[model samples]
Target: MIAIQNLTKQFGATTAVKNLSLAVNPGETFGLIGPDGAGKTTTLRVIATAMRPTTGQVTVAGIDVTHDPEAVKKTIGYMPQRFALYPDLSVLENLNFFADVFGSPRAQRTELIARLLGFARLGEFQTRLARNLSGGMQKKLALAATLMHRPRLLLLDEPTTGVDPVSRREFWDLLTQVHLDGVTIVISTPYLDEAERCQRVGLMYRGELIACDDPRQLRANLGAVVFEAHSTRALQARKLIEHRAGVRVASAHGDQLRLLLDCAERAAEIQTFFHANAISVDDWRQVQPRLEDAFVLMIAQEKQP
Candidate 1:
């Protein structure tokens, strides 16, 4: 489990994290979802005991991070955003190196290496140099290295960034298996779809924790009616609706335009507005809000004050 209270991290005059308080239960998969420079990485580093906070407190598995960082490190695994693998080292070599760093007993290293290689599906590529492997394989290798000591808590910062879609799904499947086995995970991700996979999510923005809740509850609390409008003139439709009364959000999504209205009764009026503007709509219908929708709304509201 991880606990943080009023945690603030500052670098010189720039405040990275501002009064953030959070808790993660045992065996739970918690996500820190945010955009670039939103303080997700800063908060993760503080919890991992890699960086000292300007104020507040952080604890991992009953050990205070600032007071006893060495003790906290033993109970947690921290994987940074960048690839940490040595290109010249083979997959097996990298694993062996990390095992040695963790001080795995010689008697257990063989079995542990075998199990981790098998778990990460790197058995076939054990002899392949890391530089020769694909991006996804390298990430898997880094994860295997992190698991060499079998820490109780895992801290991953944007682990899936730049990975192919298929590989991202495979990586999440592995994390799900790990979570099922009772290891607590705190992962920071920019992908809303990935955030939905977490048991609970903390939405961070502008160095502050704006919203935190289960994905479903967060979407439900949007308190708006969302509609997807498909049209050849999607851009024009967005412009027409962006400044309309009761319209909370109007943005183009691919070939379609999404609208979030403050009142469900305004749906008819939206249709009327399109007709009045001489815009031909291919289709339009109210739909359930998504995590991205809720996040955008939250950010917009936060900027109001």
Candidate 2:
């Protein structure tokens, strides 16, 4: 449903997206995963036809974005990072307004709005003003507005960034439903956990798409073993493990330290190092690598060259 080739977006001397190429199949949920300034948003904007690419081509639902952006917009729904709803408008009013903007037939507006309200779980708050809704509800409203025209593809840029954990789950549930119903979605997110939910993910770094695959495949290709270390002095444990031989990466994850070792044999050395450093090792075990681990490893390797 989406194709990008040799895409590059430049602002002044800075290139936000460089030679990035990707393709999304119909009825698939594809995620663009990366950190800030990684060009995920710039790439999405070009696909949404909101921003023109500096050099290369983008096609949405088989329509060239640069050649016919209007037609491309008609086939895709774009929800930006920030809330774009009118604060004073009631939930129903906002839906109606967007429906009108999309030229939804008067005959279909009421039924479409009703369905969207229920789908987003905002039916009870239809009479409430947009300003009165929670952050998550506001995002849902924005999504509903974006979907008013029933676009075949969704271009979402960090739709759940600041939402609470429960709301984030709810939002993804909604997205899963939409995907199941056959709306191809291309979303950008900073959350590795969220990326894991995608059918496929493209990892971006320094404006380039470095790795693209299913989450499990990416983790398996990490070429390292992951060990979870628990200690009361987690910070101290991280410090001791980071400089050890055969330890490729050590990062603090919540109250535990996640160690990426060059080989499985390094696990014993890591344990001994902690013992020698007087950093209490409450527990240590080899675990399956996560998407975050794979991403960090990809970034570290990229920096080496």
Candidate 3:
């Protein structure tokens, strides 16, 4: 459904995306994940025909983004990170406006808007002004507006960033239905759990894609063992062993320290190190590698001199 080759985008001397190449299959949910400045948003903008590639090629649904951006825009729906709706407009008005902008058939506008209102759970809020809606509701409204045209490909840039957990789940539930209907989706997200939901994930760092694979396969192929060390002094424990031999990466999550080690045997060595440092290890055990672990490991490797 989407193809990019040797994609590079620059602003002044700073390259936002560098020599990136990737492909997304029709009907698949492809996730782009990384830290800020990783070029996730830039890539999405280029694919949506919102920005031209400095040097390279991007195609959406067989239409070249550079040569035929207008045609390419017809095949995709782009929901940016920020809410792009007019605050003064009511939910219904915003939907209708976007429908008009996209040139939705006048004959089908009423039915299309009605179905979308119900689909987005905004039927009851149709009369509510967009500025009055909660963060989650606003995101849903934006998504509804974007889908007014019935685009085949969905490009969402962190659609659920500030949304509450329940709302995030609700949004994903809606996306699940869209995926079931075979609409190709490419989303960029900071949440690893969200990435795990995708059919495949691409890890971007320093403006380049470092890894791409199914979530399960990415975790399985991390080439490391993860161990969680629970301690009241989690941060201290992390600092002590983060750069130690055999310990690849260490991050503190609340009262526990997530340790990525080169081998299972390193677990005993980590425990020994903790003991010697007087860092109480209340609980320690091996844990399954998660998508986040794989991402951290890959980015860490990329930072190696």
Candidate 4:
């Protein structure tokens, strides 16, 4: 439902997005994954028509974003990283205002508002001011406002960021409901677990899409074996193998040192290295590759000369 080709966006001497291209199919959940300054937000802004691209083409449902942004806006809902809601306005008031802004028909506004209040689970708190609501409630209210026009596609920029774990789970449940309603979703998130939930994920780094695929395929493509070492000195163990040959990536996960090796044979060598260093590994076992592992590996590879 969305298409971008050779899209580039720049700010003076700096380029936020460079020669990027992507597509989101109808009814699909596409996740944009990256660290800060990875240009995910800039790409979303271009698709949302919030800003004009420096060059290249962007279209929503076949309408060129540059040629007719207004028409494209009509078919998509964009929830920016920091959505603007009238804090002084009550939940119902905020919804009403956005409905008016989107030009919802007077005849349908009441029923729409009522349904949304229920959908967002703000029916009882509809009279509460947005500033008074909990963080999670505020997010839901923002999402409800974004849905006022019933756009065909939803563009969410880290919608769950800063929310508590329970609230984050609740928000994803709401997104699942939206997806079931046949709305295509393009969401940007820093959390790899969130990206795993998408039908496809695009990894952005240095203003370019370095990898894109389903979570399973991406993990498999890492072509590395992961092993976990439990030791009293996890950090020291990580330091020993982090720069060692055949060790693709080494990181500390809680009390364990998680290592991605070039081959299973490297596991025995890593154990011997830890033994020789007197790091005293208490346990060792192979672990499944994770999307985060693949992401780190890919970004590390990209940084190589």
Candidate 5:
């Protein structure tokens, strides 16, 4: 439902996005992830028709953004990283205003608004002013306003960033519902956990796309052996194994540390280091790589200027 080819965006001497290209299938939630200043928003803005690309082309549902930006705007609902609703307006009033902007058919307003209110659990708060709502409720109101138009594609830029955990879950549920309703969605987020929920994720680094694939597939491609090591002196264990032969990476996960070791040459070395340190390595068997591990590994390998 969406196609981008060698898309590039720049400002002055710095490039915000560098020839980024990807596709989003209908009903799929494609996530773009990176740290701050990685150009996720710049890319999203291009797709949202809020900004023009420096080069290349973007076709959303067959409408060329460069040639038919207005058409692309009509077919895509864009929710920016910031709240876009009128704070003084009542929840229902905010939705009504956006519905008007989208020129939603009179016959469709009540039904669509009602369903979104239910999906966002804002039905009872319709009459309340948006400013009076809790942080989570306000976010829901913003999402409801964006959905009132029922655009075929959703370009959400970190819809759940500041939301509480419960609110985040609610937001994800709403996204799942939208996918079920056949809406193509592209979202940019910094949260790795959110990336795990996506059908496929593109990892961006320093304005360049480093990896793009299903989270599971990316992890599968790591092709490294993982083990959970727990010890009272966790820091000591980490230090001992970090530069030790056979260990490529180590990250602390709660009380346990995940170790990525070279199974062929250094598995024995890893075991020896752990045993000598008196750290209990339970579940010592090789385990699957994770998306976070894959991202960290990918970012660490980036060539520096």
Candidate 6:
């Protein structure tokens, strides 16, 4: 339930965000995908009413963020990229503190606190100090504290950054449960796999939104034939094809190299080209397009502009 139109934010001569327009529907999870310094956090802050945009309009839960900041804050929950919990506070104490800030009644605090702890999987660590928790647990604590008020809209900025794979999976599970409960979420993350989990993704770069669609839609729009190559020289293959004609893109994925060919070419053509050059490819095959491939293509185009 958020609408951002022509959003622009500037600091001195450098604009962190420019002419950005975004709409996040209620009951849906919209992801903001970008690298560091892409203005994802600045945009989030504008929507959260924590920072004012140089020029733009932001509305949360149908309330204008600038015109009714207090109302917007009251209806939305915010979990920043950086941890915002008191280092010395115990898990239970942190929740209680936020509940009080949200004016959660003393009678309702116990139940809400219990649910928050369980959802965050911090039930056993309720007595542990925040600073003593692991990276994942610290993020969960921040999320739990943000939810202490039961806000209708959840704004999470890289909720799983720096988390181990297992913890990241667990965090996504928690988010899905929260979404089922009718809370709309808007999240920004650098992880492409994480972007796949979103209902839709907004690809951002250089202070602008380049693309917005579901991961499937993004893949379909690429219109490029893809091939996967497995070889020890995958990086070398990537470098060889980086500027090669017929091959629009080449990137290394683990031990394999994923390549993109123009619509006029075929996988057989790519193999033939590499074979003629003595690239010594071990294995190659056509494969379905992935979000990572699409993101890479998008960023590459942005650089050209």
lDDT of 4 by residue, 9-84 (tens): 9999989999998888999999999889999999999999999999999999999999999999999999999999
Candidate 2: segments with Cα more than 4 A from true spot: 253-255
Task: Please rank every candidate by lDDT, starting with the best.
Answer: 4, 3, 2, 1, 6, 5
lDDT of 1: 0.90
What is the Cα-based lDDT of residue 180 in candidate 6? 98
Between candidates 3 and 6, name the one with more favorable lDDT: 3
Regions of candidate 5 where Cα sits further than 4 Å from its true position: 253-255, 264-267, 274-287, 303-305
RMSD of each: 1.0, 1.5, 1.1, 0.9, 2.5, 1.6
Model 6 weakest lDDT span, ten residues long: 263-272
Q: Cα deviation in Å at residue 174, candidate 6?
A: 1.0
User: Which structure is stronger by TM-score: 1 or 6?
Assistant: 1
Pick the winner on lDDT between candidates 3 and 4. Answer: 4
Q: TM-score of model 1 relative to the true fold?
A: 0.98
Instruction: Give the per-residue lDDT of model 1 (tens digit) for 1-305.
Output: 88899999999899999999988999999999977999999998999899998999898988999899999988989999984788999999999999888899999999999999998999999999999999998988998898889999999999999999998998998898789889999999888899999999999998999999999999999988898878888898888778889999889867798888998888788888788879876677889899999999988888785
* Top of the candidates by TM-score: 4
Tell me the TM-score of each prediction against the true structure. Answer: 0.98, 0.96, 0.97, 0.98, 0.89, 0.95
lDDT: the better of candidates 5 and 6:
6
Error of 6 at 113 (Å): 1.1
Q: Candidate 3 regions off by >4 Å?
A: none
Model 5, span 188-224: residue lDDT tens: 8877889999999999987889999998888888866
Candidate with top lDDT is 4
Collision count of model 4: 0
Residue 68 lDDT, candidate 3, scale 0-100: 97
Extract clashing residue pairs from model 4: none
After superposition, which runs of candidate 4 have C-alpha atoms over 4 Å from their true positions?
A: none
- Which segments of candidate 6 are over 4 A away from where they belong? 253-255
Clashing pairs in 3: none
Off by over 4 Å in 1: none
lDDT of 6 by residue, 187-237 (tens): 998888989999999988879999999988999989687888797778887
